[model samples]
Target: MLVLVGLLFPLLGCGGPKEIIVKGKVTYDGQPVDNGQIIFIPKGEGKVSAGPITNGEFNFAAPPGEMEVKITATKELAKAAKDGLPNYVSYIPKKYNDETSLTATVEDKAENTINFDLEK
Candidate 1:
């Protein structure tokens, strides 16, 4: 019984969750995406992590698993709107943000770097 318990203990500990660090860079049309944010949404059940994209770089910590990545970058227009509201434009396509198709597999490691090259 003692030997069986020893084997089961290791199995139980292996099933526990692992921490991971996720980091990445985002580029659009061969240019760096400056001033925006990136979000990592766990596929099933896990916490979500988001970080600011500065100079086309972003880094954050997340759980080890599959994640749906969403990249959003916006730039202020030269002129404001008629209503005086700040006008902004998104460099990335809707598929990369609203309906993202990007998927990343995070693992237990010191650092995971993922880069995204987006299109219109």
Candidate 2:
């Protein structure tokens, strides 16, 4: 019947898991991070999500689950790169990026607010 067909084909307006909207601010050594990137890596089987961080604020969508956070902020160097673009260096400690110890949870809610105050 039409009802059974509709249920069989999930592509036909079938409800599915939704992505949660997450917002937060980032600070380093008591100062707002001006420009950077924030990544939300799901601790389990989920998609990795990322967003741009500006003025210590950021917002992005992610699958609901436990997440590992990685923050990065770079400063422009005096010299230029081989591509002629301005060079930059990572100022945030590796503990906040490459080897991060920060974590957050994105639950099944309308929205979530998480903040991180980093230190050297």
Candidate 3:
């Protein structure tokens, strides 16, 4: 019974969710962005969304192996822009505005960190 239990323990561990930590910071005009949304899109999978930037930092987790990740600022800024308000905000360029359009690959047991600096 002990031998069987020992064998089962390893199997059970294998069944658990793979933990891959993804972390990054967002900045604009040489300063950390205080608010925005960061999105991680895994290759061929749904997106994982993180934050309204807290201290200009964000973190996310996913299963190991190749994944595509895209980051973007919150729509509030864009809306403000449309409203004709002058505020210090970062806007997504014509490119990289679509989450599906951005893709990244993660290798096995990797901690990936990417930083994005938005344009004026």
Candidate 4:
């Protein structure tokens, strides 16, 4: 029916929100983070985005919103591994990852860049 077709036409054009590219840097104790990952959790109903932090920087596409960020970095202890003990060590403080208090607001725009300087 013509009426039915008209109603469905607009619905076809409706897609989800556009994801903006978000880029940033990460540091610990004034030094660049060697390697890690950054996660962005939306404050409201939305999808999450994540990216790897390599050499103190990372970039990923995320929906615009208020995001709670969590950053984690770790290293493997060669000595401990050879001794058959726990070999993994997390140099970053718990406050930056487990109990993260970091927040960033990303507006819907053409570009966004944020940086996190963490301390142990």
Off by over 4 Å in 4: 80-86
- Which candidate would rank higher by TM-score, 2 or 4? 4
What is each predicted model's overall lDDT from 0 to 1? Answer: 0.87, 0.92, 0.60, 0.89
lDDT of 4: 0.89
Better model by TM-score, 1 or 2?
Answer: 2
Candidate order (TM-score): 4, 2, 1, 3
What candidate 2 gets wrong by more than 4 Å, as runs, is 1-4, 7-11, 78-85
Name the TM-score of candidate 2: 0.85
Instruction: Rank candidates by lDDT, best first.
Output: 2, 4, 1, 3
Q: Looking at candidate 2, what is the lDDT of residue 35?
A: 90
The digit string of per-residue lDDT tens for model 1 on 6-115 reads 88987876844566777788889888899999988999999888899999988878888899988898998999989999999887887987999999998768889989
**Predicted candidate 3 versus true structure: per-residue lDDT over 1-120, tens digit per residue:** 999998888787675556577677777667786666666555565445444555678877765555555555643433445558854543655445563355555445668776766555
Model 1 regions more than 4 Å off: 1-18, 83-85
Candidate 1, residue 88: Cα displacement in angstroms equals 1.4
Per-residue C-alpha lDDT of model 2 across residues 73-98, encoded as one tens digit per residue:
98889999999999998899999999
Q: Which candidate wins on TM-score?
A: 4
Q: In model 2, how large is the Cα lDDT of residue 80?
A: 98
